[model samples]
Target: MTDWTPDIVAARFAEAAETARRLPPAKVQGYFNVWPTLLRMAPEQKPNDDERHFPPTPAAVERMLEAMRWMQMLDVDSRHIVWMRADHFEWSQIAKRAGSTVRTVQRRRNMALSQLTENLNEMRVVAASCK
Candidate 1:
């Protein structure tokens, strides 16, 4: 079986965060512009200094979905801790939100990653046996 490491799981979480950022913004349904095209103001152009964002590929989106599914295995607190880290939040920030110390937050994040790694490794072995 392909061994799944905590580092690999953490990397997957980071990739999932990047994929989520690249997704298009969600809009409310049935919202239509009532203004006439002729009277509409020109759209503002972004400054050239801003980086252009491209949508994630289908494969990346699939991987993101899988990562999200894996999060279901974690408890709410662990999921929040892990996601915060994946989103690149500092340990101090996560600790503040969690009302805990930075070291505690770091420990929780590491535990969450290890849990995910173990579960994924088991899943890989099971899938291989099924074949």
Candidate 2:
């Protein structure tokens, strides 16, 4: 298996966040709400093997599917990047919430962003060169 870098994580997170933002408000809430259920349950392990075991709302399901597709396109790791993305956090508030300094939060945020952008750009360049 290939190693997943911070850039790959960030890019996926960004893509998912973008996809979520474009969706309707109800859909967004559904997407966020579904996470709990998804985290708590596995789709394949059940006595009935029922699809209904997935408790996410219709909109949540839709967002998840869309995000999944987008993540594949970016060649990024969706699971790892969830926290780095803005959707899961307010960059400025993270420091205060943790009783840390704003500068620390900003630095981490910048480092993550830069890693993602650089990796993406490198891939683009490599692809262009190959073509």
Candidate 3:
């Protein structure tokens, strides 16, 4: 396993966000359209302007899942801060949402990332020992 770092953790979170965006939308059960097909107007299809997005690779999805599991190690507030930063939200926006100063928000995010890095590195160490 590679040594974990705060930057690596942050990158993984960003990858997770992209992976999530590529996934299919969740369907709501018990929702059905009763309108007749003939009565509905067919929307114009723009073949050239199609915005098709391919699904994320299985490895990417697995990495996303691993990143999501890392969130469980953080406090709720830290999780939100980390996730928002991963989503490319500005520091000011995160601070405003968290009801804190930009410096504080940044500090908290850094600390949270550091904590995760430490945990990941320790896990790698333990795993290597067992091998």
**If scored against the real structure, what TM-score would every candidate get?**
0.82, 0.38, 0.81
Q: lDDT of candidate 3?
A: 0.89
lDDT scores in order = 0.87, 0.53, 0.89
Off by over 4 Å in 3: 28-52
lDDT of 2: 0.53
- Please list all clashing residue pairs in model 3, or write none if there are none: none
Off by over 4 Å in 1: 29-52
Question: How do the residues 1-131 of candidate 1 rate in per-residue lDDT, one tens digit apiece?
Answer: 35989988899999999999889678899886665423222365446423446669999999999999999999999999999899999889999988899999999989989888988888888898999
CA error at residue 7 for candidate 3, angstroms: 0.5
CA-only RMSD, every prediction: 5.3, 13.7, 6.0
Task: Assess the local accuracy of residue 26 in candidate 2 as a C-alpha lDDT between 0 and 100.
Answer: 50
Ranked by TM-score from best down, the candidates are 1, 3, 2
Question: Model 3, range 1-131, lDDT digits (tens) per residue?
Answer: 57998999999999999898789567799877675433222366556334446668999999999999999999999999999999899999999999999999999999999999999999999999999
> Deviation in angstroms for 122 in model 3?
0.5
| Top-lDDT candidate index | 3
